[model samples]
Target: MITLKNVTLRRSAKVLLDNASVTLNPGEKVGLVGRNGAGKSSLFALLNGTLHEDGGDYYIPAQWRMGQVAQEMPETDQSATDFVVEGDTTLVAAQAEVRAAEATDDFERMAHAYMELHDAGAHDAPARAQALILGLGFKTTELTNPVNSFSGGWRMRLQLARALMCPSDLLLLDEPTNHLDLDALVWLEAWLKRYEGTLVVISHDREFLDAVTNVTLHIDAGKLVRYGGNYSKFEDMRAEQMELQQAAFGKQQDKIAHLQKFIDRFKAKASKAKQAQSRVKALERMEKIAPMLADADFSFEFKEPANLPNPMLSMSGASFGYPPPEDAPAGTPPTVIVQHVNRSVLAGQRIGILGANGQGKSTLVKTVARALAPIGGELTEGKGLNIGYFAQQELDVLRPLDTPLEHMIRLVRETAARGQNHGQGTREQDLRSFLGMFNFGGDMVKQAVGSMSGGEKARLVLCMIVWQRPNLLLLDEPTNHLDLATREALSMALNEFEGTVMLVSHDRALLRAVCDEFWLVTRGGVEPFDGDLDDYQRYLLDEAKRQRESLKESLKEPVAATTKIAESEAPKGATGTFSLKNAPAQRKLDAQRRQQHADKARPIKRELEGCERRMAELTQEKARIEAQLATPLAPAAIAETGKRLKAVGDELHALEERWLELTEEIEHTAGA
Candidate 1:
């Protein structure tokens, strides 16, 4: 169990946790949630031992191993399989022991080391690692690709896989689904459900938390509050709590008013002075109940557009794709991802774009947004047709060095240049006021966009889009950076908006809340999907399994499962007998035995190497924490470091013990 007793924590001058306490039992899947900057990450840091309490005590069982995704981008040429395999430090250490024993030329030690290596899953490491990779939406062909060859988002997925590969008693995942599409997210939820450890995840996707978490930990106003259910249940319970708190506060206010009135009316009279004084004392002693104030959660509404265009856009045999790069030869043909797509977007239509990652979803959206042109088909826009587009990479359209105000001003200039101004004011003050409505008030309007958080930037993009008052909204993964409050706010705003909407998002809540229909982009074509989000999820899972199975089938051996080295139970030179006494032949017999041992051990050794890397990581962290303690530090900080050191040390010891036990069984089996 993990316990924080009356913990008071501060990040700089800000009090993140004030006398906060909570207990988390083992094997619980907890969702840690709060508004942005509500100390969720701070609590995570405290749990992982990077931050410390200024007051009170925090404790986690010393023997429990912990796993967390590394925030840094991985930079390595190692194959993806090797990279994930190395995450298991236990296997690495076992392999090291084998090499050392072989160097010493000790036969018994070699035998023991071989057994340990087998137990550490040396033979099937790549297979297990590839499974994790594929589960996270990687192709089987990419299993042996260099890690550094992937893009940033894919690299982050790899980071997640590496964390999942580590053997741990506790796993901490922060925004684990931000980079994932729907298919990958579903796979991850299934994986976490099967994990036999304590899981604490921070995610903005409401459905994800509900799927993976059995408990909810909410941090609000410097207090840690535990809820006995998942995210949706937490919302319902909190709403009820707020309702009750408000009623209590109203009653308290009425009582206080009555007490004050009696005191004021009777204090001047001689006979009633004593009674009035008692009432005054009663008022003074009364414990006040504070009113439940809405926590200034981010909320906004879309501005009603000046006009609505029926059949906002029409595509006839439209082909959505990318043009050749500038460096490509002149005759190179454009890549057509989606072709022969006849679709119509009418006013007030809400559409959800459904497809696997890289299956032309984004290409279709890019064409609709005018970022790409149709290859060999007609795409026509109705008069007064206006689109407010949110690209998946917000940075692609956002100028990082520019401030929010500057971005708005640029929008205005471009809008005017196109002679498409709708009656809205383009004045600087009006723009500033509009930005303020999106929570970019005062100096925040001038803050460089590059320095803002992802959520903030996303809000800015939404603000600019609202200012345009477009008759059509094209949003691609708009909720990627938004927290729950803002995501809900967007959902509400979209529901109320009268514009035509085409959305591509992994957020199921948003899709369910706003989309009236779904358009699937698959096999280079587009068509209406007559199914709900649940059906789409099932389709994704089935497709993923089928693709993976196909890849596995391609790599399977033609030989029978029970194929072995001999036609009969006899020696190579002798008939119906086996002997090992031949001096030169003894070595061959021993070698054969070792190979047989390893081949038979494959089932027992499957998937152990990935955890061996975790042991190495802990060893390094233990050393770093030890060195940190050696330096002069604040007493509280030193205490925190000491706690972390003990945790790492005990975790390493536990891993070593488990490794020995696994090797022990394998050794006996191999010897027999």
Candidate 2:
């Protein structure tokens, strides 16, 4: 167990933790959550003994080993596998001792060294390291590649793998999922589930926290607060606490108001002078309750477009990827990721784009946003279309040396230059006010973007996007650098926006809150996902299992073939050949079997199609009813519509279940 009693921690002259205390028991998985710069990292530092409390006591068992991901970017030519394997320092030391003992020709020392190596499990270290690498999304072929050959994000994965490879009693991971794709994130979640050691992870992803954590450690207002259960439970408990606190504060304020009113009414009268003085004394002595501070200081909305085009954009027979080389031969074709995609973006549509990394989610967004041209076919924009695009890489659009004010001003000038406002000028003061709306006020507006934190830079990018008054938004991983509060604020703003949104994000909460539909990009095709996030999760798990089974089958092919040959050569009737006399009968029997299966499946297939059509109709009706509810409607009409919508939803659910059953039945019959 680890305990911090009255711990007051500070960096420079600023206090991060003020008399805050929390205890962590053995084998507990804790999620440390707070705003950016709220001392979550500082707490990790204290736990690792790199930083100490400014006051009071902090204790950890001396025998316990700790492992944490390194923050510095690695620059090494060493093979990736070797680098991760080196994380097992005990194993490395034991191997070194064995070598030394052998060089000295000391039999007794060599025997002890061999036993130490066995205890450290040095023999299987390579396999363990490789497994960690694979789980972190590296291919088997890349295991022996030089670490320096990989990109920064891949290197960060290596760092995470290295941390995981270490043998320790406690493991600390900070923002471990930031550089990971959904596949890797899912794998990491499973890996963390099987881990036996005590774990503390800092993450802004709520779904991830709920999946992996048994406890929540929330740092707020310079206090370390511990809550049982996961992030969702913590949210529930916090909301209830806030409700009680607000009620008490309201009651206290009423009492103070009553006392003040009495004092003001009769303080000048001689009979009430003593009482008024006593009231003033009492007021002075009474403790004040501070107003509750909101979780986020910022909120923003997309400016409504002047025109709402029915079809905001359309892609017909389009291929998304980079342009071909100009100097290539005439027959050289453009490299495409997703080909022959036909999609339409309608007014007020909220579409979430999902895929594994490098599967063209960003490519599709870039092509639609006109940051990259379509490799083939046409992408037509509706008349009066205005697009707002948020890139996943903040630095790609942000000039590091420029301030937030400069970025907004440039946007205004660009809009004017493009004749977007018909030569209407945008003033610097207006830009400053717009920036201030994003929490970039006072001197902060003039602060250089290079000096700003990742969250600040991300906010600046978003502020610029919102200022464009675009009806269609293309966002790629917009929540990457945002804190939980900012993410909540963004989610709220997205929900309220009237514009069409096409977002690519790993944040499940954002997707669930904002997206009306989901599109899947995989295997050179883009198609609609018929279900929700839960369905998508199950699909990923099933896909992973299938891939593993395929690999196993491929590995067994040679041995299985050798066994078949042996059986064929040794045993009578082990293998049979079709005789000419029976060939006609066998063909007739095969045709009968095929016809029987087709007869069994044809009605199911037809019913499945019918169910799909009905499901689509119900979905559209539900959306229409929701839109009506959002408008000004009579209370009776609203109630009636709500009931109808519920009925439609229930029917849709039943239809979906039937559809799944039909699909499975058809597939099973065909395979048979």
Candidate 3:
């Protein structure tokens, strides 16, 4: 267990935690959450021993090993697998000792070193490291690639894999899912679930917190508060506490008001002057209860599009991929990823693009966004179509040296150049105000984009996107850097949006909240996915299992072939076991078994489809109720509506769980 008692921490002159205390038990998974710069990272630094508390006691077991993702990009030429294997210092040391003992011809030392290596699992370290790397979205062929060859984001993934490879009692991960795709994020969630260690993770992804964390440690107002459950439960508990606090504050205000009235009425009279003075003293003596501070409420809406064109875009036999390499032969063709992708994006459609990393989800998005052209086929945009594309890489759209105000100014100028506007001229003051809506105000608007945090940059990009008032939004990982508040704000805006949205995000909460349907990009093709995020997850797991089985079969083929040749070379009378000739029959039987399993799952699939349809209806109804609740109504009407909303919400939640269970059942039946 680790404990911090009366810990006072400060950075320079700014106090982050004032006598804060919290305890984390061993093997506990805690989510560290707060607004940016609320000292979440500072507290992490304190735990990692990089920073000391100004005044308090901190305790952790002395011998326990701690592991954390390295922030610095590795700049080495070492193979990726070797770099990950180096995370296990004990194994590396044991291997080194074994090498030294062998070189010196010391039999006793060599024996001891070999035993140490065995205990440390040194022989299997490469395979374990490879597994971690693969789980983090690295290709198997890239295992032998040089570390320095990877880009910054991939290097960060390598760092995460290295941290996971480390044998530690305490693991610290700060936004580990930031650079990962949905497939990798799902894999990481499962890996963390099985991790037998204490985990402290800082993440803005709410679904991730709910899936992996059992405790939530919130930093607010320079104070540390520990909640007993995950992020959702923490929110509920916090809301209840705020409600009680608000009640106490209201009571305190009422008492103060009555006392003030009595004092005003009596203080002027000589007979009751003493009594009035007593009242004044009592008022002064009473301890004031502060009103509960609400979380920052950020709400913004995209301006109605100038045109709502049905079928915003259509592709015919479109091939989406990168352009041909500069050094390629003169007639070389562009490398196509997704081919024969004939699809129509309709107005008001919310489509989530799903795929593994490097599987061309981004490619499809780019093609639709017109950042990249279709290589072999035509992509037709509707008349008056305007696209607001948010790239996964912030820097791809944002200028580093420019300030927020400057970025907005450029956007307005570009809009004016394109002769598209709301008739009101874009003024400098208006641009500043627009930036302010995204939380950029005062000096923040003037701050260089290069110096801004990832969340800030993302917000700037969003602000620019919304300013365009495009009819269709092509968002690729738009919430990657947003905090919970900003994400909620975006979700609300998207929900209220009348335009179409095509989103590719690893944030499951955002996807579930915004996307009405999903498109799966895989194996050089794109098609509609007839399921939700839960179903997609199950598909990924099933696909991984299939790949493992395929690899095993491939590995056995050569041995089987060698055995067949040997049997043929044997005497005719020799005992011939069930031969390779039966392999085709076995495969046929396996296919039959698969077909049987599918037949068994047919009813369950039908039930899941019904559940999904009901869920959609209930979701829309709940949204309608919520919108009604937000309006001004009589107290009785409001109460009735609120009760109905709660009932609907409960039913919706139950249906969602049922949908997940049904998906799992179908998956299990199929796999079996």
User: What is the lDDT of every predicted structure here?
Assistant: 0.78, 0.78, 0.79
Q: Which stretches of model 3 miss by more than 4 angstroms?
A: 99-111, 247-294, 423-425, 558-672
Clashing pairs in 2: none
Estimate, for each residue in 47-143, the C-alpha lDDT of model 2 and write its tens digit: 9989999998999999998889999999999989889989997888887986687586455566566556656865457778988998888875577
Residue 353, candidate 1: Cα error in Å is: 0.3
TM-scores, one per candidate: 0.75, 0.76, 0.76
For residues 258-320, could you state the per-residue lDDT of candidate 1 as single tens digits? 434433443343133322233333223221211221233466777788888778998998888
State each candidate's clash count: 11, 0, 0
TM-score of 2: 0.76
Question: How well does candidate 2 match the true structure, expressed as C-alpha RMSD?
Answer: 21.9
Candidate 2 ranges beyond 4 A from true positions = 247-295, 324-333, 422-425, 558-672
**C-alpha RMSD for every candidate:** 18.6, 21.9, 22.2
